[model samples]
Structure formats: C-alpha cells, structure tokens
Target: MDANREIQAPNSGCKHGGWVTLPFITGAVVGLTLAGVGWTANLIVYLIGEFNLNSIDAAQVFNVVNGGSFVFPIVGAIIADSFLGCFSVISIFSCISLLGTVCVALTATLSSLRPTACNGGSGSSCNHDHPSSVQFLVLYGGITLASLGQGGTRFTLATMGANQFEKPQQQGVFFNWYFITQYAAYVVGATALVYIQDNLSWGLGFGICVAANFLGLVSFLSGNRFYLHDKPRGSPFMDIGRVIVAAFRKRNFPLSSMPDDYYNPITQAAPPKKAFRFLNRAALKVEGDIRSDGSIAKPWRLCTLQQVEDLKTLFRIFPLWSSSIFLGTTIAMQASLTVLQALNMDRRLGRHFKIPAGSILVIQILTSAIFLTLVDRFFSPAWQKVTKKSPSPLQRIGIGHGLNLLGMAVSALVESERLKTVHDQPEPTPIAPMSALWLVPQLSLVGIGESFHYPGQVALYYEEFPASLRSTSTATISLIIGIAFYLSTAIIDLLRRVTRWLPDSINNGRLDNVYWVLTVVAVLNFGYYLACAKHYKYQNVEKEAAYDTCD
Candidate 1:
C-alpha cells in the first residue's frame, strides 16, 4: 500500500524569500515601458495630428498598435524557453523598448525637419510626415520594435516572478503577492502616464517612458545573481503537432479500446522504471501495502515517457477556459476603448479647472493599491480558512469573471445614462453634462474584477501546466488575449449593424452602443463562466496522492 501511494513528488524545494522582489522592480520597468509605448506615444500621436479624432478612430488605431504585443508573446515565449531564457529575454527586450521610445521622442521633438501634415505623419498627431519615406518607416518601425520588447517581457515577467518562489506551500502566498504587485504595475502605468500626458509636454512624457525602459534594463540585469535562470523550452510546434496526432488517434481508436494494460492506473503493479508510484487512497481496492492515508509513503520512481504521455493526455482533455477570454477582453478595454471614451468625457473638475480625461486612469491604480492591501493582508488568508478546502486558483478566476460582468454592467449603465442625456439635451453641455463621477462605478468594478482575474489566471496557468510546457502555456494565454481584442472589434461592428435603430446620430462614432454590447457579452460570458466552472475540476496531484493514501 505504501508503494502504491508514493509516486514522484513535485520539485518543490526552495528556501528563497526575496527572489520575488527582483521581479517587482522589473515589473516597474515594464510599467514604465508600457506607459511609453502604450500611453505616451498615444498622446504624442494625438498632439502631432492636432485633429479631433473621436472614440472609434482612437480605439481602432490603438488596437492596430497593441496587436503587436499580443502577436509577439508567442514568439517571446518560444525564444525565452529555447535559447534566451527569461532573464536574457527580458533584458534584451527592455533595451529595445528604450530605443523605440527614444526614436519616437526624437521624432516628436524634431518636427521642423518635415512638412506639417507629415509632421506627425498622416495620423491625428505626428511630426513632419516622417521627414521622408525613411523617417516614416523609422517612426512606425520604432513602434513595432517597442511592441516586441514590451510583449516579450510582459509575457515572461509574471511567470519568472512566480518561479522565484518554488515550494508549493509558499507558492500560493508567493503568487498572491506576485499578482498584487503586477496589477499594481498596471495601476502605476495607467495613472502615471496619464498624468504625464495631461500635465507635461508629450516629448517629456515619452522621454520619461524611455527612461523607465532603460531603468528596467538596468534593474533586470542587476538581479542576475538571485534569479533561478531556468532554461526555456523551445517552440512548441512539434509538441502541438504531436498533440494533434494523439487527439486524432483517440478519436479513431475503437470505443471498446481500453487504456494499455501497462499504462492503466487500475492494474499497474509497480511504477514504470522512471515513473513514480504513488498510492491512491481514493481507489476502492488497495492493491498494495497502504499507509494510513492509503498512500505509499516513499518515492517509487522518476518520471517516464509513458507517464509524460499520460500527463499529455490529461492536458489535452482539460476543458477550455472559455470564460477567461471574456475576462481578458474586459480588462483589455482599459487599454483600447476606455481611453477613447475618457477622451470624449467632460473633464471639468469644477468651474475654471478641468481634470485631464486621461487623469481618471489614476482611479484604477489607486483602487488596485487599495485592493492588494485588503486581499493580501485580509481577504486571501481569511478566505483560505473559511473554505476549509483551499480555493483553487481557477475558482478565483471564475469569481473574477463574475466581477468583470458586474464591471461591464456598470459601464453599460453609465454609457446608457450618457446617451439619454445627450439625446434629450441640445448638446453635450456642462449644465446637464453626464456626471464624470459615473465612470467611478465602472472603474471600481473593473478594479475588483482585475484583482481576481489577473492573479487567478497567472496562478492557474502555471500551476496547471506541466513544467516542460510552461512557456507555451503562458504564451497561449497572451495569444488568447490578442484573439479577444480582435473579437472585441468584431463585437463592436456587430452591435453597430444590429442597432440600426440607434441611428447614426447617437453612435456617430461614439462607443455608446458598443459599450452596451460589451455589457451583454459580459453577462453572457458570466453565464458561460458558471458552466465552465461546473464542467471543470482542479487536480492538485500531490495533494490527491496524499488524500488517496490517507483515505
């Protein structure tokens, strides 16, 4: 029974406590870089074009720019795993981003060299339509380069940060802190960049971004000694192909076909030479000497190809985290549409003073900072005790999806109110202006949802995937986000066509209709999320073995 219960234990030994701090520093760098490429560049572009581009134009153009990060994660993940490793990949990308930032800032500052229309280029704001073809190429090219660096580092940083705390017991706590800090980075980026763009010159704002990326490079390089520096797996193309083949075989295999006797969990007498044999107390019939927990008390074998294949099979059948895609879309709108919407909002603080519309972004950051304290110092530990069974990372993710629905619902209400006011009034006037305060509920709901979704997804992705496939698994999550961006685009278009009753007068390039559409999507996504939760179950393999033996 002891032999049956004891299989291979996971590689959980690590005495490191401060390894996570390094990533936090690196995360700040990422935050700054994101501000530069994502926020500062946006302001610069708008200023250069010096035109009143509306919400739709801003969302669409930004989507085109943001697409690079989504597309690059797969590349970054593959490279990080196969050759560069996380640290090197992160450093190199930071440096590249710094260069991209410099290029854009210089272009903005050197506007006298080209025609005014081309000053910023053909877009809303640019300096000198690229001075020449070469300048234009260089400017746009710089943006793409920055995207590569940001995307590469963004995908790897969180995973690498989590890697610092390796033990299972510590992993949960470590991840909690890990997620808190990461979300905090977004908060910092959004708030800080918005302030810079609103108050400071665009050149200064972008220069700050460049400096942040440069500092990120320095900080990441400084931490070389403490980091684990694990070798990244190469591209998963071969693995993906193998997975497809195996899936096809499973479909073609006879219905009567049973698992191979040698691989069968029910009849296996001992662990395969390299496979660990763990006793499962959950088994009704104890095939061997069972310990108190009905588990083998010692390690039996190492991992084997067969066991690896079996694990692969387990991964293949795992239910799709379909609802997560919606959560991603919700958070993503902060980057894409939310900024556009804010731009259209009345930024009047009171009489003579008006806040920058972008300044509202601070609300998200402050909210995250507040929530992180509450969750880590209060909610997480307390919830752990109350549940008796520790909350599965995926469950946290599910709750996050629910929150996303609530967030979008709030956003829909605010937009609906704005629409009503605009329709009833002669113009968008201060006397009957839709209160900017309404955006508070929307932002707050998003913050709460983010508190759950981002952290939960990070932990769930890493904990669920086998080590050999970590890079691909992490990258896939980013790819899914990218897909969601395109999906949002499609959703917006569909809403516009479906609501012909809305009249072009209302939608007239405003995102009011689209915001409501997102709300419906969020509600539907929430229902789908519940279904997904019902369909899935988490497998803490180590704990399962322990429980099997004790039972």
Candidate 2:
C-alpha cells in the first residue's frame, strides 16, 4: 500500500484529509484536556482541604496520580497498535473519564465521602481527622479511573490526529496545534477551575469537569464518519522479541560484505547501517531459512533486515531517551514544590485579588503555550533562513537542556531568597511576606525549555520508529514522564529519610538545597545528552527532511 493512501472507514462517505476533521478533533482535545486538568491541577489542595491529608502525603499522592496517568498511555498505545485503533481506544477512555468525573463530583456533593475540615493550625500541627476507609475507597477508585482515562487519551489523541494527514508537514502542523491546545487547556484548568474550587464550591468545580468530559466524548464520536482509520498491524513488541531470539540463534553466523547476503524485504532501500553490527546476524539467511517463494520458512531462525534495523533504531535512541528521564524528574519536582512554596508565600496580587496556590502553575502553562506559537511561527523559520536548514531534533533538544538547567538555577536562587525572608522575620507568620511572583521566572524558563524539547521529542520518535509502532512512538514521551514522576516520588522519600532538605513544612526545610541538587543533576544529564546526540546517526534521513521542511 502507498504510505500516502488513506484507509476508508466502513459505511462512511466522508473523504479523508482537508479541514473537515481538524475542528472536531481539536474541539475534542480541548474539552478532554480541560476536563482532565481541571481536577488534577488542584488535586493536592483538594486532598489537604477535604481529605485532611498532610502536605507531604498530598504531594506524594499527587506525584503518584501524575505518574499513573502518564504510564497508562503505553498500555493504551499498545492496544491501539495491536488490536483496536486509536479511535476505539479514545472512545472507550472518554466514557471512562466521564464516569470517573461523575464519581468525583458526587464525592464533593456528599459530605460523607470527605473528612470534616481541619481547625486553624499549621497542617503539621493540626490534629485533623483522616478520611474513613469507605471515603478512602471512593476517592481512590475515582482517581484511579480518572488517571487511566487520561493516560489512554492524552498522547493517543495526538497520534490519531496526526494520522489523518499523509504529508509529514501536515502532521507537524497538527502536532503544533495539538500541543498549543493542550497547554492552553492547562492554563484554563489551573486558573479557572482552581478558582471555582477554592472560592465557590468543590461540587460546582467537579460538575464542570464532568460536563467538559461529556462534551469531549460526544464531539469525538460526531466526527467518526470523517476519520481515516488505520487497521492494527499486530504487536510491534512481538517483532522486537523475534529479532532478539533470531539474533541469538544465529550468534555464530559471520557477516558478509554484499547487500544480498542479508535479507532485504524492500530491495530498493540502502542496506542497514553499520551501527550495532552484531544484530545484523539476525538477518543473515542460512539453508532452509527462506522457502521457494522467498518468505522465511523458519521464522525464529531468520528475519528481514528491516526488522533487525528496527531493533537497532531502538538501541540507538535509548541513550538519548534515558538522558531525558532526569530532566523530567527535575521538572516534576519543581512543579510539586513550587505549589508548596506558593502556599507559604504571599500570593496576593493586589488588595482585591489573591492567587490560589494551585493556580500558580498556570504561569508555566501560559508561557509554554506562548512560546510554542513563537517557535512554530517565528524562531524556526528565522533559523532556517540563516542556516539554510532547519534545526534538527537533537539541536532543539540540546537547547531545551540548556534552558532547563537555567530554569533549575533560577529555582535555586529564588528558593534561597525565600529562605532568607523566612529567617529575617522577627515573628514568623503562617504565610511569608515574600511575593509568589518570585517563582514566575523559573516556571517561565521551564516552559520555554518545554517548548523546545516536547515537540522535538515527538517528531523524533514519530520519524524514527518502525511503521508498525507509530502509535507507540508518540507515547514514549509519556513513558519518560511517567517514570520521571515515579522517580520524583522516590527521590522525595529518600530525601525525607536521609536529609532535612524536604521536610513537610517548606518554611523550615532546606528547599534551596533540593533545587541546587536538581540543577547539578540537570548539568550532568545535559552532558550525557550532548554525547548521545553527537554520536547518533539518523535512521530515516529523508523523513527527517520532511520534518525540517515543515519547520
């Protein structure tokens, strides 16, 4: 089949491609994201206020929830690639999300599902009642369903939307808009829904989320007739496994210089590159390996060169991927800690208005959204004009690493200043006199870094991955983020056990030390990333040109 050909949906007259599906897809993305982020952004606050959890416990729960949300995408992606396609997976998850949101809304409306409010005191000192076992079960059940829904839909939607377009340039445009919608939705959720929850009522806030989710699901279904449905091509993981087994079986086979010595399913393309040469033995044909018709007779003993090359692609990319894990860890830590910092700091913008601690993360989301537009529209084109070629994914990622380090440094400095304010007070108040605005610069810097790396990583994975693993390619970033969030939780636990840097109360803890530690880690990770990028060669140089042309 031609790569550009669109697969027609059964019993649908709507033609694939053009602007017909974009609006509906974009609308669904907006609604789903808005609903998902609305509840999650204020989760720590919700736990502390309604469930009467401690600061540390709330933060840990938030990290775990975020981790679960990201990690679930891998499962969703695999199901899409191996059985049901993206549309089916998304529809099922959307319904799951609605049910979860409804349950959460009921919890807010029914006092029995939440613990009584704590009396005025430091969260550490307050003798607050914990949620009952029944309450805990309901809360966990709601959040678990919600997290699974989010994980299934988030990156899978991006892949689905991109699949509608055949041209890589068109797909690139779709990704830019997809991220723009995602971050913009985060800004709204963190700001508007958070304010409603903080000021009006939790029930009302959660009700809004339920409505948004319903709308998303409905809008997605309404566009089913127009979608280009890709049929499942079986499990990519199994192919990878076969390659490993086949290579081991032919361990003693000597590599030959001629192209014909190795099996090439597509005879026209260049032979597999020399990198990871040991794996090439898997494609080395022996007597009885190929039948009369040129297909493999002993599947476990022989494989096509493309299969071996696909496995090698994963090996080449793993180092770069692993290096990104710590960068994500640093960002996750900053996200959770900044909220705590805001909770303790003076959050008032003026006499009439005060910022919700949970909403402070909106600064990062807003900055990322703005920078994404600028990069897509201005910076990339400007660079191309001067250099005669667009910035490569590795180069964009390198820039992101530099900015991420800068952001961490800024965080350390701001924390140091906040600590100084803590010490200078003659009598400490519950909230410090230092303004929360001091946290904005660091968040903004991180957002700018994200603008560079997030899309770069997406484009890299989509272009490099095996055709059968297209959906999984986009979800790989989600996997990194999920691991990072889990690692962030582990790191926090270790800090609490071993050092005084991450006490429940940020006022007395050496929070500055945490940021400094993250900064150092970022520096080391960036060095490792540089080494990986320098040594790497593009597996799909022509496809990379398509991305460059789009940029």
Worst 10 residues of 2 by lDDT: 1-10
Residue 298 C-alpha lDDT in model 2? 88
lDDT per residue (tens digit) for residues 1-551 in model 2 = 11522455754555765467898888889889988898999988888777777777788889999999999999888887778988999999988888888888888999988878755524565445778999988888999898899889997888788778877788778877887788778788889999999889999999999999999898989888888887776668878988899989989888887788888876755666798888888888888899899888988888889889889889988998998899899999889888888888998888978899899988887887789889989999998898788888888888899999999999999999998888898997767789999999999999999999988898788777777666577788999999999999999899889998877678889989989999999999998998888777677777555434212
Each model's TM-score? 0.73, 0.92
**Residue 344 C-alpha lDDT in model 2:** 86
Q: Which lDDT tens digits does candidate 1 get at residues 22-99?
A: 564555555544544445335423533432333344455456566667867777767766677666777777777777
**Among these predicted structures, which one has the highest TM-score?**
2
What's the lDDT of the predicted structure labeled candidate 2? 0.84
Task: Highest lDDT: give the candidate number.
Answer: 2
